[model samples]
Target: MSDHKQNPLSREMKTHAMILGSFVAIFWVTELLDMSIFRGRLDRFGIIPHSLVGLRGILFAPFLHGNLAHLIGNTIPFVVLGWLVMLQETSDFWIVTFLTMIIGGFGVWFFGAPGSVHIGASILIFGYLGFLLLRGYFQRNFASICLSVIVGVLYGGLVFGVLPGRPGISWQGHLFGFLGGVVAAKLITNEKRFYS
Candidate 1:
């Protein structure tokens, strides 16, 4: 009953270009607004220590940010890593991103150091990076592995980004995002031998 032959490319499948472009544009817009006057309230709705007790910040934390620097920093990796995931597997890319956000967000709230409130896209960044790393290994694509290592190196500084006392920062969120990426990468995709 279904005509796979006649399905419009746009309707049937999303391309890497579309996925990457959308993330770039959306992040740009979000960053611009973050630089605007509403900057002070970034964490107002972000995942807070108290949020876990209430179980409300899981969905909202990933969307919140502390400042332009924070938003832009996370966006760069997100666009790159998200593009990789989008390019590799279309079916579960969005699902993976969403899952990373929820799980990462909740993880931070629950496990982060006490009195620490979290914000920003660190979870998504790490999630994308994590998937790309594992998927690359499973696929045994030399190019993919190299790319992942490069990204890993670039974002390695993120570990420090998760620490406190930096002023207007939410390092805990970064930690959660990183952990979320690893967990999701291992759980979502089946571990397999090198394909090529």
Candidate 2:
């Protein structure tokens, strides 16, 4: 057998990553523009978890990070997971991503304390990971199952993202993002077979 992983790449997955990259790039650039042009009004809109006026922050907050470091921190995983999720031949790729954002953001926005507006790629990444991993069970593909186990074991540090973090970082975002991922997985997964 080939030692290399079966390339998970496929038409649907390629499109998914492209589309996600498109959005992330656009958003990142737009936010940078906002910072440069608007004297940083764009970041003022970040999800601040203030509860009273912080709700809209959740919708667009992930787009704004403290600095290049912050932006890059979220971007890499976003791309990786986005790419992985897009690779899914299943039709729910985009749906799961969009829904994950909604569920993940809203969950934090609503349930999270007003002072804790979370934003990051962990939820989306975990969702993507969970869905892609579990999809094997639904599709009855032994290969996907193996991939899922590997992903879980390899990316185990994902669990650490949920904790309080260095200044200007939202561990809350990681938490919400993870929760969103779980919900998305359940929604997109097929029930017919555990290995589908």
Candidate 3:
């Protein structure tokens, strides 16, 4: 009956939640190891603009952070927005995340100042924010439109992060990460859900 139908959906939700939680857990664990065993040296793996050696950082940067404060600041939004993206379709999370890292990381690598390293999950965060905010406009679905409005109202101030002027901050990552999200939104459209 109704209970049988709900059970499968509930189990799927749990699986999606676990996947999202595991990703955040990896961030925390990476930070802990970097702080204790690596003694902050792990940050060198972060994206360094225009250098061949720095190119490897494009794969590593999002997992690295400058300090506890930086990591903490990024964790909440990463979890919340990340969860929101998964709610529509769990696979979108992987697609959006991969796109953000590649597109956003390349932006930092190409434009980031010499001798500077850019790191942190904020790039993915801004990318998620961008995807969530714009997905509705592209899909023209009522639920997505409503979700976009809520995301905007709750996280609107993040728009300022895209602008240049924050010393030591990679506005390039923010700008391009957001663009990456828009690209994700354009590329992936949600399949119709039974519940919706």
Candidate 4:
């Protein structure tokens, strides 16, 4: 009995870890390639607004980064918040990630400067932050609400990132990523019932 119960729980833990780890690995490997072999040429794949060729960046930009500092800055928040989002349900991770990419990516593609190239995982970071912060309110569950409070307390500073004041910063990505989270929370969590 004990072994059987532990098996499922252990499997879940492994799956959760694997999923988050894969995302991190992709980011790191892509950055490594861009820095070493590609010579930063991969950055051109990032979002460029209003150009047909640039539209592909919406799919690729989240994996590319401006430099090591940018990738490092995004890595922690991306993993931490992503794992937290997964805690609700493993599937929630995929839903949130897809929505964040599509919504957040397209938002940048639409609103970003014509000549500018936006590259970084900050879009997903802000997406995870936004989903975590708003999910509780939309779901109206005690645990989710508590999680939101904790997330807010710890990462509330991320709100400032959505503003457009910083140079070379893609505030549009941050803002849209956050909004994507909101959209995910509203669409996914509202129907979920925590209590019988």
Q: Which candidate is the best by lDDT?
A: 4
Task: For residues 15-67, write the lDDT of model 1, one tens digit per residue.
Answer: 65677667667655655676685666545666666544434567656666666
Name every residue pair that clashes in candidate 3.
none
Candidate ranking (TM-score, best to worst):
4, 3, 2, 1
Candidate 4 achieves a global lDDT of: 0.91
Give per-model CA RMSD. Answer: 4.8, 5.7, 3.1, 1.9
- Error of model 3, residue 190, in angstroms: 9.7
Report the poorest 10 consecutive residues by lDDT, candidate 1: 187-196
- Candidate 3 per-residue C-alpha lDDT over 1-196 given as tens digits, one digit per residue, 9 for 90 to 100: 7765869778777887798778778888999999999999999999999989998987899888888899899999998999888877788999999999999999998888989989999999999999999999988899889999999999989989999976988898899899999899988864333235
TM-score of each: 0.69, 0.75, 0.91, 0.94
> Which should have the higher TM-score, number 1 or number 3?
3
The segments of candidate 2 whose C-alpha lies over 4 angstroms from its true place after superposition are 1-14, 50-52, 115-123, 133-140, 165-167, 191-196
* Residue-level lDDT for 138 in candidate 4: 88
On TM-score, the leading prediction is 4
Off by over 4 Å in 4: 1-4, 193-196
Clashes per model (N, Cα, C within 3 A): 2, 18, 0, 0
